[model samples]
Target: MGSLRTCSRSACERAAVATLTFVYSDSTAVLGPLATYAEPHCYDLCTSHAERLTVPRGWEVVRLALPTTPQEPHPDDLVALVNAVREAATDRNQDTGPGVRGSKGTLEPPAGAGAGGARRGHLRILREQ
Candidate 1:
């Protein structure tokens, strides 16, 4: 089951109903419906915050109309999600194959993997534009 996304505003614990993305090149801010997945560079906002959103001086704000009612996930979306999870699990198992375990029964990064080497982690750092 999926968990509710919270607003990105400080001390605001309201459920997010919109996603805010900034287009630096156009000096524009886009406020749209909640994204399927959370993005590092985007902000998730509640209805109130989204409605009251303000952009920097000279910046344009583009508001995308949100749906009046929540909708169920499509079958295709559910299938895709399941496939992605299975692929990730397969990849993880392959990386931590036999003899790659630490003495403490923990998985160790494969040869030449990690910081200053091949990336092997559940989380990835997004590069700034």
Candidate 2:
């Protein structure tokens, strides 16, 4: 949601249309569509630079084509978001009491939920690659 970044080329002020990344160890140059977030070591390139990009002596240039249809929020997404907000604003917010997270990331079932009937309470965090 921050401001859009422009090309890194000197004296050429244009909205960055692609991202340029170089892998020094692999001798590869990846020039693709702009990333969701700006990276510190990556270079932002405009359309001209993206099309006329070049690689180093033995480096391979991998150009990625951007998707044609932008994935903006559709009507269904808006309706779902609105419904979620309305649900959170209603009485459902009072069900979640404090001490939801146990001593060390343990799943302590909510009040008045049997051992194994159904998952009445929700929200579990799992770390997987």
Candidate 3:
């Protein structure tokens, strides 16, 4: 049997056969050898952390460039990647304020004023000028 190891990350204390391997570029940990595993490679982690395992802060995750086989990527992978990119784009947009192009126009209030107040509905059309 292979020797057991613990996660090198300071906050973790999981024991497993394989410790996460990191590659260094210049003075930084640039990537990992086991980053793209379809399942949790390490053991003893809670469900949440195990599900979201990846290269830590300051490490640039290097994706595997292997040729794709007949099998397609898992749906979970597509969802995770898309969600990550969306979150990153949102963060960048918030910081930069909608990029080179100005506002895509403004959001105006609904056309008709409600009797007492605005009645919340499923779909409300904005009155854009």
Candidate 4:
């Protein structure tokens, strides 16, 4: 059996055997092995960093599972399905209007537009004379 491995995050020094691996643009790290282990969904977490975890932005801890018999969609089939979905989404987002100019247009208003042409309230509101 493989020995427990420590978290790769510089701030953390926790031991983990089956860890939910996080693969970012530049680095890969583990979350935890957990006390009560399970296949694919161990709920163990690092108490120290629990409060700091912000979903979608900060560290995303996942449960590690043991290798099991492969089931469901085949690899090639899954790849094809993903490609199809991506292509569909891209097509939906593409500009069907005039030309390249329409392609540059955004779905929402530009940054500075305010509600009812009112100045942004967050900025300092000068009292009218």
Candidate 5:
């Protein structure tokens, strides 16, 4: 989905919460939910602009139900968060083997930590004795 769009009305910089479109044949102005993609003929409006919208003398105004609350996080986003936490936990657990101190006083990964449990990047997880 696209980021929050600003109201199309000039000089009004509020985030758009609704979309407005006109039906020339029916002489009606429709105000509803934000469009998936902005169209040349559709106008994106903020809460104030959408509520105060007016049309020509003979034009009818049709207002569709607007969302009362903010949008929730996408399911994919939640799943990604969970996966990242799991990966971090797994990495920490794999580094639990006692670290060996080299001649240079640098801690080295346990012998079996090679190949499969190879340390990633320059950072290593340290556990208290």
Candidate 6:
């Protein structure tokens, strides 16, 4: 059976309940629901770690508005995320050396893409219009 995701914190085996992502450009940490798919750079944290999470003195954590209870993950969002991961993995395995020609690579997403490059359903911190 597929097991629940474990916390990203080293040496811990507890199932993750939340996800944490860092925006290094702005020195901000964004904590929200468990990601649809775990991106390599994002952190999957267990309840205890998430509750006690901290950052360096100059950094900030922005906790998005989460529902009072755990809810089901959206099917469409999960599918999109899984597809993105598969595409990325496939590209990695293929040789992209200069000797290979006429390969149309996946285009980079335009600005406003969600964190960790998932296409949709993310909690974004937008500036006032």
Maximum-TM-score candidate = 1
- List per-prediction Cα lDDT, in the order shown: 0.77, 0.69, 0.43, 0.44, 0.76, 0.74
Q: Is candidate 2 or candidate 5 better by lDDT?
A: 5
Extract clashing residue pairs from model 6: none
Which residue runs of candidate 5 sit more than 4 Å off their true CA positions?
1-3, 77-129
Name every residue pair that clashes in candidate 3.
Answer: none
What is the lDDT ranking, best to worst? Answer: 1, 5, 6, 2, 4, 3
Number of backbone collisions per candidate, in order? Answer: 0, 0, 0, 1, 0, 0
Native-referenced Cα lDDT, model 6: 0.74
TM-score comparison, 2 vs 6, better candidate: 2
Q: Candidate 6, residues 95-122: lDDT per residue as tens digits?
A: 5733367543444454775555534336
Which run of 10 residues does model 1 get worst, by summed lDDT? 102-111
Candidates in order, TM-scores: namely 0.57, 0.52, 0.24, 0.21, 0.56, 0.51
Kindly state the number of residue pairs that clash in model 5.
0
Off by over 4 Å in 3: 1-72, 99-129
Tell me the tens digit of each residue's lDDT in model 4 across 1-116. Answer: 22243443466666433334446753534554344434444223344443244446454545345333222335898689767965764675574643554353323334565544
Candidate 2 — which residues are off by over 4 angstroms?
A: 1-3, 67-129
Which 10-residue span in candidate 5 carries the lowest summed lDDT?
A: 97-106
For model 2, how does the per-residue alpha-carbon lDDT over 1-118 read when each residue is reduced to its tens digit?
A: 3227889999988778788999899999998878878999999888788888888688898888954433343689778985785566443434544444421222334556554533
Look at candidate 2 and tell me the lDDT of residue 39: 93
Least well predicted 10-residue stretch by lDDT in candidate 2:
99-108
Q: How close to the true structure is residue 107 of candidate 6, measured as C-alpha lDDT?
A: 44
